[model samples]
Target: MQRGLSRSSSLPATSELGDALRACRGAFLGVGLMSCMINLLYLTGSFFMLEVYDRVLPSRSVPTLIGLIILAGGLYIAQGVLDLLRGRILVRIGTSLDEAMSARVFQTVVRLPLQSGGRGEGVLPLRDLDNIRSFLSGAGPSALFDLPWLPLYLAICFAFHAMLGLTALVGAVLLVLLTVLTEFMTRSPARQASGLAAQRSELAIASRRNAEVVVAMGMAGRLTRRWAGANASYLAGNQRTSDVAGGLGAVAKVMRMMLQSAVLGVGAYLVIHQEATAGIIIAGSILSARALAPVDLAIANWKGFVAARQSWHRLNGLLRAMPAPTSPMQLQNPSQKLAVENLSVAPPGEPRVTVSEISFVLQAGQGLGIIGPSGSGKSSLLRALVGVWRPVRGHVRLDAAALDQWSSDDLGRHIGYLPQDVELFAGSIAQNICRFDPEAKSDGVIAAARQAGVHELIVTMRDGYDTEIGEHGGVLSAGQAQRIALARALYGDPFLIVLDEPNSNLDTEGDEALTRAVRVARARGAIVIVVAHRPIGIEGVDMLLVLKDGRMQAFGPKETVLAQVLQRPAAAPIKIVSDGGVSKP
Candidate 1:
């Protein structure tokens, strides 16, 4: 019953990173203006030297010398103030960027696993955002901003003498060439190193998380070797990048020093020829060095620059691939009726469908049990129903409105879902049960825990509902985690409840509690769907949907479908000998 999707003519969208950058355009402009003022004030030292040597010393006027010193001190103070303001502005810009993009990046990270079928990683986006922020507030970007003033410094040198200006210009061009060469040599290896580093970090984190398994299985040595291999590759790539950049940096430093000396020598010649004064000679040397300083600083910080650039590209790509956020519609809460039409789902990054042409309808005050053998798509169907996974074709609607049409926050309020593998965040029992709602009522949280039959268990704990659950609820046992997760799903008495193997970790009492919880949910007129494998698991369900090999094998009232399946002829038996040989009968 599934249908193919239709193609649309819309072009791809831009990234939130771009939007954030545009929003900060005003701040950047202010920073640029600050840079202009700072660079202008940078002339204070050279001019002070010129005034002292050219005017005060010749006139032997102590008052003039003192006044010049005071003026120079005031200019220096102004330069310091401007520098401080520019630094503060950059910090603000970085903070603003984070404020704008952090929430969106976090949302994308959470959604990526579903969109890409569990193939996406979350840490990289967060890491990229941090990298961008650090670079903005670091010295690298300031170096770039100051780079534009290099030509102005050269012009000041030219005003001193043509030879001095030529020396400064040649030196600037040489340093610029070195910077370009540094980029060309290190670009590929730097990129490779960054990718390898991320892989190493991921592996290390995984190993730490599964340390018990590694220790119990005596896999420490093997895993260590694997990590070492990846680490070595990363180190090699990093060393290659560093070697090239370092070599160029050394050459640039030497060339800058030689340029300063050459400027001094040329200025001295001009002074001897009576074309320039002693003050002009010193001033020319200072301006020439200033002209080349930004280039040298840029070369020295090339690694940071490359890393930030790569991070920017990655974040931009991730944001671009993400769907734009839609304004939340003022839609009313959906009624408990649920419908699935020709639904099909495929695993992420794979073309083969896992579940196909699934169609069903369930109204309020009814419960359905999905029974299937291993690999029968039962869990996949439940996931699709609850909006955890997107269907390849067709629609899942609640009260005739498509699930995608509802805002997630609004839909979440009306839907409750518990997966087979349960997880609880690090918080108190009450917080987890109440879905961490800041405004959750105490009575409501207690009611949910009571409905799940874990209220007695909570009372026995040292702090009752206020007891903290450690990371992933590691402080609690398997049964405790499962029951707590059930309480979380039953919170607020949601209209649509989907549970996948809710009693998988429960004992006899727990199982009874689960049955009662389902009955209670049905009594409240909720649409309940349970995925199960055992007969007892489906005891209270009114309808049955049996799946086999991704197709619907049977669907109807539980007794009718059960009777039909039971009456069908069973498969022929095979005769087996004591030697383990089997004969078809």
Candidate 2:
């Protein structure tokens, strides 16, 4: 299981996303330029009305009127073309942003379990990325881009008349204030709604995943009520935000419409007083409407803007907290020298340690059996050994190098692990046996199956190695899934194998297969550690490690530990001596 040269060195820490945005700066610039031209051309309609009223009609020249109409049509066509170009540029920018961030977001999701020790939802990051992409391509950002040109339109209004300009400016300021009010009123409630929505989603997912249990236990009504409570909370928060934003939006719309009419009224008064011409009166009304268009649009889409902003902050914070990928040292594959020094591990998000100050060492070709009652930190220790759970203190080393020093992908190739609850992904039997390695060879897959003693049983299926396993291997029996998971752990002849309850679902034949697999792995110069409750599961193990209440009880050759355990009084607490010895109470 040799790895290729390190590719992580080429990946920048948080700069790739920045670089992607920078790459699109030119495109956004082009969009801005097009928007400027589009806004400038928007005056064509006002100008057309002005010339027809003031010049064409008075002059009574059909040629002048026809020429103005043709020129206005050409300007409208140019504006349409620029509008289309800018829209296309925004769409391309959105696509480019997705292309740049999607892969990295997916990578982060895949590594989340390892980084957080199996806590957190993996799908949320992708959802956040999608939110960002949608916002970038949508009408919301287009309105923001046009917003800066509002002043230019108001200037055009001022050139028409000072009273018209003042009316438009006051209207714009009021709408801007309304926009701010919408944000202030809805921000907290919107954030609350988003969080509640996520919680409701997770709850629904959990309920669906355990639908069978809920049905068998007759918990449908209770679970439904529970879900309903969460949904109601989500709806309440959503409604509050919508009410505030919608109310402000309606007021802003009314204000803009009234302001447009008010501009026309003011311009008419100015015209009557001979302060402005009839053409300027009509032009002022049109320009005033144009100035407030972007503000209206921004208010209409305020909720979407808030959602995208929150998603951006969340995604940025998550990515920033993630450790930067490092170029792993080109270390040779370990030859089964495993060492755990003063290791302590706690559950994720919990302060209490599950396994504490445990230490051990094993050389190549040795097999150790760990036996303990439930909740004795058996599985926790195994997780630490396989690099699934990082140590809270101290370290686990392979061949004298800390496990954290290796790239996860490279290290996974040399280590095999089977958790207490075996789970097989949705795929063919061959794929699961090969650990889903796309480049796995057929021979290697079959060899691993044979090593796990499930080759003959697998052949009995109609599709043999190609048989499709349903989700979580639901199509298979408990014993069948356990054996297949063992085969997966034994795949690629990994130097270090950690198995938790490998024979919990096995029968007589399956138990014999388990023993044979362990013996073969040991003979091939691998370090094997099995966590079991049954004595038969430890048949060929050369050493034994006993744990009780998160502390080591005994660890030595299998025969010596077994003898010591056998001699202890059955009803009394086993006394642990300071010199790694055990005595009866």
lDDT of each: 0.84, 0.86
Native-referenced Cα lDDT, model 2:
0.86
List clashing residue pairs in candidate 2. Answer: none
Q: List model 1 lDDT by residue over 361-437, tens digit each.
A: 88898899988789989888888888878788989999998888887888888888999989899999999999999
Candidate 2 per-residue C-alpha lDDT over 1-585 given as tens digits, one digit per residue, 9 for 90 to 100: 000001111233344455566678788778878888999999998899889888987889999998999999999999999988887888788789889889888888887876676567658888987887787788877798899999999998888878989999999999998988888898899899989998898889889888999999999999999999999999999999899889889999999999999998998899899998898878888888989999999999888888777776677667777745676886899995999999998876677899988888899999999988899999989988988778899999999999989988789888989888999999999999999999999999999999999999999999999999989898899999999999999999999999999999999999999999999999999999999899989996899988888888878888887877789798766544323655542
Q: lDDT at 228 for candidate 1?
A: 99
Model 1 worst lDDT run, 10 consecutive residues: 1-10
Residue 257: error of model 1 in Å? 1.6
lDDT of 1: 0.84
Q: Deviation in angstroms for 94 in model 1?
A: 0.8
Give candidate 1's TM-score. Answer: 0.93
Best by TM-score: 1
Candidate 1 residue spans exceeding 4 A from truth: 1-14, 572-585
